[model samples]
Target: GNNSGNLANISLDDILNERVKELYWEGFRRSDLIRYGKFTGDNYLWPFKGGVLSGQGVAAYRNLFPIPASDIIANSNLVQNPGYN
Candidate 1:
């Protein structure tokens, strides 16, 4: 929208990275990192992402969402997983 065109020297990578930062907190960081091949690697990381300050690949078991006790009590159809409460 701006006619100044002062950033003609900016590289495509820089522009894309800037946009990714702008949309990071809006729930695009995960997909963006996956697309860029940085989600599960040591090169690029964010604080407290995978339960570490420096970021790392999370354990597969950590992906489970534990069912609450109350829900189990009310629903007999619910079967508590072997390793979960």
Candidate 2:
């Protein structure tokens, strides 16, 4: 059964309008706020869960993946990516 007839023909603007209506400004608002530098000033760091902290130490430079640990270990000549110790 071709059910395509049940769907209404829609344009990109129509889809965008529907998304704006459903999401109600929440999606783009965050980026707009951040672009104005609002996000950085606030306490934006996501709280690290207990397991992650225990395994990796308190969330610090070392907490981030260290240039993909396997990559760093395999290639002693390659410098570890910055922000990971």
Candidate 3:
């Protein structure tokens, strides 16, 4: 069915909540949050977000996890993920 007519532009908060509801404890909790800017940043913080109950923004660079040193050392042709050299 073409349900697009019923859909509205969901807010980031709603998206975050939906992720938690649909994926909590399913192993993607952290990744989900990061994807939506909820894991880091004051946009949508949860417990201990920045070491405080109120939460804080993690380094934006952290969005792109660093490539392992071993891999970087082993493959000269490979480049590290963004935010890391």
Q: What TM-score, over all chains together, does every model reach?
A: 0.43, 0.26, 0.62
Model 2, position 23, has a per-residue lDDT of 76
Cα lDDT tens digits for candidate 2, 1-85: 1476565567654654565577775786334434444333323323342244323223334333467778878989988856665
Q: 1-85 in candidate 3: lDDT tens per residue? A: 1466765567777767787788877888778777766666666666777788877777777777798999989999989887786
Give candidate 2's total backbone clashes.
0
Model 2 pairs whose backbones collide: none
Of the candidates numbered 2 and 3, which has the greater lDDT value?
Answer: 3
User: Model 1, 29-77: lDDT tens per residue?
Assistant: 5566566666665565678767888777654343345788899999999
Candidate number with the higher lDDT (1 or 2) = 1
- Report every candidate's CA lDDT: 0.67, 0.49, 0.75
Candidate topping lDDT: 3
Q: The CA-based lDDT of model 2 is what?
A: 0.49
Off by over 4 Å in 1: 1-13, 24-26, 58-85
* Candidates sorted on lDDT, descending: 3, 1, 2
